[model samples]
Target: MKTKRIILSALRSLGKNKLRSFLMMIGIIIGIIALTLIVSVGFGAKKQVMERVNKFGAESIMIRAGGGVQISQMSANQGTTTLKLADAEFLENIIPEIKGVAPFSSKGNTDIKYFEKSATVGLLGCTPSYAPVWDWNVTAGEFITDEDMKLLNRVCLIGTTVQKELFGDSYPIGEQIRIDNIQFEVKGILEPKGTSPGGGDMDNRVMIPLSTFMRRVANIDYLSAVKVLLHNPKEINTTAEKINQILRERHSLAEGEPDDFTLITPTEATEMAEKVSGTFNLFLALLAGLSLITGGFVIANIMTISVNERKKEIGLRKAVGASSKKIVLQFLFEALAITISGGVIGIVLGGAGAVILGIVMQIPVSVSWASILTGVISASIIGIVAGIQPAKKAARLNPIEALK
Candidate 1:
């Protein structure tokens, strides 16, 4: 009954000064909207990044040679040569837990041409095992087979972007293309993979058999890295340890010698990305939260002025048997009602803005239940906290003096 009367009084007061009430909640509206948009964008980015990583087989680990170690053999008289095909084969034999191993080498800049179109693409050299390790989907034709690798076939599978650049509407399969002046047939086209958030152009690569790459392009029997597929992501640490032991022994490294290779898991990459995203979101949230705090102060100030203006009414009510508690409740309810209404409007407007931005920007937008609830609850709390002191002051006023 008291709650109903207080709410009714709050409604009447707000109705009497609609402009003033709206002005008081401006800060809160801005705060909620900004916070909602920031959170939605942050979570959307995280989800997209994880999806990309998952496509690469999250359980897989990449083992790459340390800096400046390109080849497998180094002589005292000659220069450095870091990774060899034999090393990869040896690791496979020694590490029983590894499901598969695909040693890869790459040429960063390769002029590729098909018909009248041309593009400079990253030429990846790997065995057929790479198809499984990388979880690549060949949309048309077929992936490189073990037999093709054994025979060192001069054939290539192009990324979707590469196909678009080189073939246009023409069927790429069996079409002849030139890579570094060497002729090769188009064996496959990879499924379209959207641009990575980290700016990796996954759709602009070309893959070829490792043997063909060594003989024709790089003219070297070495690899830059070895991708290993594990039976499960849970065995990441164990598999990493085993690979390290095998590589150390194979490289004939003595105790205390620095490792010449590094192993990285998808989880590590995901965690790093998440940390970056969290920091960015936190900075934005803080800025938005500051606006909310400022809005609370506005509400407090307005309520204070309201109490002064209504002093005569308050005095009359008190003289007519209104308790101090009832007066306090009335003012607090008014503040809360204004803030809660503002919160609702802010959420709806923010969501609409996010949807429009997502369409325009070509990015995902998400609104979680927790975020909506948090906004509503936080706004109400802000109103209550801001109004408390002023409400108490009004409640404690001397009715006789206030009537003056």
Candidate 2:
């Protein structure tokens, strides 16, 4: 009952000086907001990174040709022996762990024209299964079918940027676009994928059937890369080993000779993204921590001044038979109450700030309970510790001298 009375008295004293209490809470409020916003940004970045990694599909692998010795090394060899479409076909025929393979070649930064409207874009030649293998969604018309591949049809699917440049929001289906003087009909428009987290522009590419590209465009029997889709992602290492063995045998390469191709997994891409995000999160957390430390110092300063101001009151209570321990409890409880209130307000503001940033900045923001609890508990501890020095000073004051 006595402790309860002291707490109530402390709260009443704080209420009497409302503006001062509000001023004291300002530091804490700012600290909470900063911490919350930074942590939420970290989580948002992680989400974006993970989403990009998954865009390549969990079961996907890419095989690309590695550059060989220079032309000067051998007069007859210009370093052109590389992974071919036939190699991909052979793997498809033999490898049981491989679900499917799509051979693709691409060239970028070329001007394409459609009825006088022209734009510089990337052009890629790929098999029919490439679309589903990469998880690309078609917004209109249809993707290249087996019939298109068999006939070597000059049909293409355009990215969002190309569609806007050539067709300008109107339906681009049935339109024809000329790439490097070769005409192709627009069969579909890929759903807007925007820019990737790596800053690559996926929305500016034009995709065409591999057969058309081989016949009319590059005229090369070799392929730039092969996308290998696995049946199971967890068995990637084993699958890669088997693929290397097959490729070495097929190429007739001797021992200690490096394979002419590179095999990359989606898991490696995801790990790269995670490492980048982790560093960003650490930087943000450190920046926010500094602000929180400054806030804690401000809280300590205010509590100290508060102890000085309430010295006469403390003396009066002690003269009226209040114990030193009771005096300490009262001041400590008052500081705690003020801090708890500030902490609550800070959390609400911080969460609101995160949501507002997500909407306005066009970035995703997420707040977990762990972050909230950390902020609240840290602020409360700051208040309790900051108030101690002042509380002890107030408790040890000479009552007679305090009254004078």
Candidate 3:
């Protein structure tokens, strides 16, 4: 009953100066808002990144024609065309862990024309296994076949972006498009893949037979990269090592010579993405924490000021029958009321802001219950910590001295 009265007294005291109470809570509100936004955005980004990384299939591995270590997806050395079709065949035939192999060469920023319409797009030459290796499916018609490669057929598959650019609403299949003045029949339309992890448009390319590209366009036997799908994802490291040993022997690299090819596994790609996201989230979290600490200081200052200003009220309560413990409890309860109210308001505003930002920016935002609980608990802790000294001071004031 006495505790209830103390709580009511604290509420009444805060109500006396609504503006000051609101001002005291402003720091906590900002801190909680920052915390909620950072957590939600971080989670969304990590999820989106992981999804992008897994687009290549968790069991897949890529061997790019490069000498240096490949840290990022877009950093693979495109100039080094050491990888060959024969190398892909060799790996598939020799490595028991390999399920599928796709050897492909690419020429980017090439102009394609269908009558008056034209678009600059990427041109890829790949085998039929490329589709299965990359988990790509044709929305219509079919991908390149072994016969197409054997006969060096000038047939191509266009991505959705290229389809829209060149053909528009007209049926693209059975239509012919000229690449560098050479006409190739469109055999299929590829499903939309949106964007690559490197932020490139995945559905802005045209794919044709490897032989056709080699004979007509590139006029080179070397491949740009080879994608391999493993029987099991757990064997990626072992398979990569075996592939490295074979390639080193085939290339006749001496004991000290560096590898001519770079091996990139899906696991490595996912790890790299996770590491980047984790670092960013950590930085944001630290900034939010600093904001919260600053808010705590603001709260402490306000509470201290309140204690000084309410000295007479404290003395009056003590002159009656109120104990020192009750005085401390009253002040603590007031601090908690302010912080809790601020935290609730901040959470609602932050969540709404996150959703609005995501829609405007075309980014994903995921709000977890954990974030809400954390924000509330953090606010409560800050309030308690900030109010402790002031509460103690108020409790220890002599009735006569405080009254004077």
Mark the regions of model 1 whose C-alpha exceeds 4 Å error after superposition.
67-81, 196-198, 252-257, 353-365
The digit string of per-residue lDDT tens for model 3 on 277-303 reads 889888988888888888888878888
Instruction: Tell me the lDDT of candidate 3.
Output: 0.88
Worst 10 residues of 3 by lDDT: 69-78
* Candidate number of the best TM-score: 3
**CA lDDT of every candidate:** 0.82, 0.79, 0.88
Error of 1 at 245 (Å): 2.8
Query: In model 3, what lDDT does residue 202 have?
Result: 86
What lDDT does candidate 3 reach at residue 2?
88
lDDT of 2 by residue, 351-385 (tens): 99999999998887888886688788878887788
Pick the winner on lDDT between candidates 1 and 2.
1
Per-residue lDDT of model 1, residues 294-395, tens digit only: 999999998899899989988888998889999899888988988998898888888888889899998867877766887898799999998898899889
- lDDT measured at residue 196 in model 3 versus the true structure, 0 to 100: 80
How far off is residue 196 in model 1, in Å? 4.6
Residue-level error in angstroms, candidate 3, position 42: 1.4
- Give the better candidate number (1 or 3) by TM-score: 3
